[model samples]
Target: KEIVGVTRDITEQTKLQKALEEERDRALLYLQAAGVMLVALDQRGKITLINSKGCEMLGYSEEELIGQDWFNLCIPEEERDKVKMVFEKLMDGEELPYEYFENSILTKDGKRKIVAFHNVLLRNQEGTVTGVLSSGEDITERRTAEEALKRLNEELELRIAQRTEELEAFTYSVSHDLRAPLRAINGFAQALFEDCGEQLDEKGKGYLKRIQEGGTRMSQIIDALLNLSRISRGNLTLSEVNLAEIARSIMKEIMEQEPSRKVNFLCPPRLMAWADARLIQIALTNLLHNAWKFTSLKEEAVIEVGERKEGREKVFFVRDNGAGFDMRYVNKLFSPFQRLHKAVEFPGIGIGLATVQRIIAHHGGWIRAESTLNEGATFYFTLTKGG
Candidate 1:
């Protein structure tokens, strides 16, 4: 009976041992499978345990890392003292300022990598602090990318500031230097026309008139250029703006200027958008004026200002029954000084659409035109919601 009892006891003991070994193996497997580096340090700052990821990151075998001084081996020479101090404080039962922190570690290849670590204190069953267990993620690549982006942003800001300064200088020259000569030319031509009218014949008077017209046209172009420059550089003040009201006001001004012309203008009762109010006013005015100008030759001129929903976006448009151009030239439509029609026919300096495009772009919006030659044209634009 005693021999049988001994054999049964041995068998049960063997089974219990096997079960403990299996549990340990499972725990080790989980640590090895962890994506981040898992490390455990003893009270003396020696590595007690390290996972496969920690071994791979340090370029060392588990055998080499185990029982090694963690701070002296893995930490960079410059940071070793600081890191060791923190470990000592933790061992002394001081709470760390942060449970999560970042530092640099030395690699086997003499390279340094940034690590973001989340650390916790390990304790014995007696409630005494034993060591620290840490899970660290190598953030070298991410930190490098973020630093590069910051540098690039700084460079871009510098370039923009320089460009703005240059633009201001150019604007000043145009406002003073160019306009001075232009005013002189127009003033002299007017004087010649008034004073020498009796001495001048029809042809001479016609020449003087043409000179005056040329000077006036130049002045208008200079003003347009200044406006374009101003639109390109400014802080945007976004607000809720009634686009329909602005369009109606612009049309009213156009009608008053040309009261003899009969035209049909249609605008919705209300069309609202979130954008820079002044900028939107400028854009709408240009679009409405273009519509009125293009449809002047038509006996039944029809111009409409309206809005519609395109998916989640609100699309506002100006439609006109006018002399539209070929679709092929649409690419050049928004370029400054690019005109599809002759100046005599269009009577514009061709900067209107370019200005409109800049204003739309500033609002984080886009504009497009659709047209069939002599049929009609519609200009559609969408503003970024909430500006």
Candidate 2:
């Protein structure tokens, strides 16, 4: 009977040992597969255990990380003394559940990474303080992105401030220096027309009229420049805008200005955008009016306003079979007072395109033109995708 009992006891002991070893292996696998880094340190700040993630974050091997001085190996030199003091406090019976803090860790490659640590005091079975257990999250990428965004915002603000000052100077020059001489010239020409009308010949009278007309055109140009400046400095009110509706409204105004012209304008039913309503209306008006003026000589003029998908963006374009300009002068198309057509061909102050460009740029969008002489011209643009 005693011999049989001894054999049975040995079999039971072997099964228990096997089960314990399997459970230990499962625990180690779970630690290795954990997302956040896991580390254990002895009371002397020496690393007792470090998982694979912890080793990877430190840029070291498991053999190199384990049993190394945790404070000296991982903590940056300037911060090591402060961290060591806190570690010592935790070992000396601190009752805190966890200490949450952010600090830089030195890597094996001599670079530093930011880590947010959740540290807890470890204890023995007898409830005596033994060491510390830490779970660290690598926040290097997040911190880098935040820093980049901060710098970008700062630079943008500085640029805005400088631009505001420059706009102020431009406004003063246009208002005072430009308008002052224009008023005097217009006054003198009118005085000649009234005071010396009988003595002046037909040609001399024509000169006076021309001088007055020139002054008026100059005033109009000045007003257009002021409008452009306003667009640059104004605050934006963003909302859902219907491009088709805006185009239709602009065409109506154009038809009213010249009731005899017959033009076919094509616009989709529900082309939409997210932008400032007033600014977008101004842009559409300028583009459509430009098409109407250029197509005056054409017996049958066609204008289309619509959107098409290009890559991940929706590009909106205005196409017209009008007096298309040369591609060589395309670079000058959006400059203020830079005219491609002679005054006899199409009368304009040349600020329309520059105004359109300013509005588009303010909306965080870009504009481009494609044209070949006498064929057609297309202006394509994209709105700011995200704010």
Candidate 3:
């Protein structure tokens, strides 16, 4: 006993206690500097502790907020009663499953702010409810931005609808008012050819024929424009379409139109697409027909319809060994009434590719062409799924 009573140095124990207290102070300082607002309220709903962020959010100093009644001091007047009732329930130790809610708070400057809060019940080791610990975020800016975006989208849609209606009316006027005159010019030219062949020489007859052809070509352009407009205005009926079947059917009709041309057509057995059937038909018809027309000069021509992947996207292509174009002019390929080949060399008013572009755009897709002079051309397009 005498040996055990000898004096023992307690300096190490005091140093360890001091280190622990310093670590706890550092942790509290970090919490106070946290970006999120943090607060603790005693069972009576009086503020027990509030971090620096919490005080900044309410525009108050710690001295002013601590020991203050939370519901009465911080909560907006409109929400104070409801918050007090909920506070009472929490104090009564009601078993709540993780409370999270949004409310407006009145800052010390009398300005209001929307706060989204997540709350946890503080309990002692014996499971006795002691207070409430809450973390909050200021959501005023985010909510305002979301509301502004919603309004902007609605306004944009209304403007688009109005513009589309005006465009439709203008297209109708061009189709009706202009077509009747073209028909008359074509009719008169044809009548001249039929009734006055004996009175005119070869050059006059050729001129009349040119007039008739030009009028007919104009009419075809008008029809193509109408078709293009309709594709944009029509309501899309989206469904799974067998693209290969459509290609084969179009090939059959094209072959019948020019039986003497030696052209080979190949397509996959079951190429599929998600698109409006009618619109897709028009697009494919233009592409395939373009291939057929351009390949007319070649003694042996080949055309293929297939789909392949570019990166992660599925790109459908119409390929041909025909008279391709100079890549320099590719920029104008999809423009209405723009042609790379001479009208005499390729029989078209140049609306086909434009129509195809409109159809692809309506389906939220893109189209491109690759060609080399005298070698061949390939057209690639993408149609979005379920678009």
Candidate 4:
């Protein structure tokens, strides 16, 4: 009976030892598979175990690293004392200042590398701290890239500010200096037609009329340029604006200008958005005016202003049955002075869509257009709270 009992005890002990060995093998496999460095140190800050990644990062083999003084060997001489003191205090039951931190370590090749480490205190069965287990990731390349990108962004911002100042000076020149000569040209042309009317022939009068028209058109173009420049320079004052009301008012103005034109304008009630009210009004006016102008030849003209949901985003759209443009030229639609049609066909300086785009961008929004030639066009936009 005693021999059978001893045999059973030996069998149980063998099974338990095999289970422990399997668990240890599995743990070693996981440590080796880890991408980041995994390291364990004893209470005296001597390396107890280190994974393959840790050995690779330190430019040493696992056999050379185990049982070595971690701070004296891996840490820089300047930081060695401070790091050792902290580890000693942690093993003596004091809490660490931080569980995660970044520091520089010396590799075996004598190069310094930045490591971001997450550490935990390893404890015994009685809850006494045994040592520290740390997982460290090499972040030297990422930190370097981030610093370079930051400097690049600062340089870009400085350049943008300088360019804005230069543009403002040019705008002032166009507003004051250019307009003075333009006014004189228009004034003298009108004087020539009025004062010398009886003396001049019909051809002379026609020449004066053409000169006046050219000066007037130049003034209009200047005004449009100034308006486009101003759109990008201002601070936006945002409020809850009723887009439906603004659309209705714009359409009303267009209809009043050309009372003979019969057009159908449809706008939903209570369409609201958070935007700069004045800027939004200007954008809507431009879009609706374009729609009204293009639909002039349509016998059954229809324009609609409304909003719809695209997933979680609310998109507002201006749709028109008008003399729509070709999709191939849509890429140039929002560029200033880029006209898809001739000036005779569309009496515009071609700054309207560009101005609308700037306004929408200021409001942290975007705009896009879709059209089929001679069929219709739709301008979709989204507005959010402005900065």
Q: Which runs in model 1 stand beyond 4 Å of their true positions?
A: 1-58, 62-150, 232-234, 259-262, 310-312
C-alpha lDDT (0 to 100) for residue 247 of candidate 2: 93
Which window of 10 residues has the lowest lDDT sum in candidate 4?
Answer: 1-10
lDDT of the candidates, in the order given:
0.90, 0.88, 0.90, 0.89
**Model 1, 347-387: lDDT tens per residue?**
99999999999899878899999999998899999989365
TM-score between candidate 2 and the true structure: 0.63
Candidate 4, 1-387: lDDT as tens digits:
355443345888899999999999999999999999999998888999999999999999999999999998999999887777777777777666757778889999999989998889999999999999999999999999999999999999899889976886688566767888999899888887778878988898888888888999889878877777787678888888899999998888889988998899999888989988899999999999999988988998999999999988899999999999999999999998899988788788888999899899878899999999998899999997642
Cα RMSD of all models vs. native, in order, equals 7.9, 10.2, 6.4, 6.3
Model 2 clash count equals 0
Pairs that clash in candidate 1: none
Q: How many clashing pairs per prediction, in order?
A: 0, 0, 0, 0
Report the C-alpha lDDT of model 3 over 1-387, residue by residue, as the tens digit: 355556889999999999999999998998888899999999988999999999999999999999999988999888998877777777677636438778888999899988988888899999989999889999999988999999999999899879977886688679868898998998888888889888999999889988987888788878877777777887789999999999999999999989999998999899888988999999999999999999999999999999999998889999999999999999999998999999889988888999899899889899999999999999999999474
Please, what is the TM-score per model?
0.63, 0.63, 0.69, 0.73
User: 1 or 4: which has the higher lDDT?
Assistant: 1
Best by TM-score: 4
After best superposition, candidate 3 residue 373: deviation in angstroms? 7.0
Candidates, ranked, lDDT: 1, 3, 4, 2
Error of 4 at 193 (Å): 0.7
